[model samples]
Target: MNKLQVEAIEHGTVIDHIPAGMGVRILKFFQLTTNGERITVGLNLRSGENGTKDLIKVENTTFTKEQADQLALFASSATINQIANFEVISKYHVELPEAIDEVLACPNSNCITNHQPAKTRFYVKQSDQAPKLKCQYCEKSFNVELFSELN
Candidate 1:
């Protein structure tokens, strides 16, 4: 029997354990493909028994702490591995940010952010099933999934 392996990056970041359906969303949400960097994506990979996960490897590029924190909205269980010289230099789980600004639009159509020129902001509130984001403008709370790009 032989096991397959993904080629390791010489230096970059690997995001692992993303929820199966969220990988593509994360990639687009973070604009990971816009920089012309080599990105290897594995979707619906085997995880634990009867479970699936997604993994992404970005070659020669690294994410900032802010980006990592934002990833928590998409995949809270995701882990970031920083590799250098084909070795992992650091590994950590993404943390939910206290407040997200200028990243997500308020779900409320009547929100001030929708009409006026303003930076969207959301205060994070954790729930049993998913995180809630409260709009700074409309004061309405919505599940994280309701958010999209401000533009």
Candidate 2:
């Protein structure tokens, strides 16, 4: 028996276990495609634990801890793998951040971040359904999905 494989990168980051259907949103949100890096994306792949999952491999790019943590909004079960020389050097799961600033644009059009020079800020509120992010500018709580547009 033989199994197909995706080519491994020499040095980069691999995001695994993304909830199926969120991979494209993440790619667009992070502007990964605009950076000119080779990105391989697998969607709706069979998963032992989650039944289905998405995976992303970006060559020559490493995501910071803060960036990885932000991914928890879309994929709480996701894990980041730092690869070097085609080997995984480090691996860890993404954690939801307490607060995030200057990354996601507030969904509210009337928010100060959209009108003035104030940076966008949100306080994370984890819930059983979905994590809500309360915009610091307008004081409105919105589910993380609404803040996917990058600032």
lDDT of each: 0.88, 0.88
Clashes of each: 0, 0
Full-model lDDT, candidate 1: 0.88
State the displacement of the C-alpha of residue 98, model 2, in Å, after optimal TM-score superposition. Answer: 0.6
Q: Per-residue lDDT tens digits of candidate 1, residues 1-151?
A: 4343357899999999999999999888788898899999999988989999999999999888887888998899999999999999999999999999887878798888888889988998888887898888889999877766744
Cα lDDT tens digits for candidate 2, 41-108: 98898888649889999999999999899899889999999999999999999999999988889888
RMSD of 1: 2.0
What lDDT score is found at residue 132 in candidate 2?
96
Model 1 residue 70 CA deviation (Å) reads 1.2
Off by over 4 Å in 2: 148-151
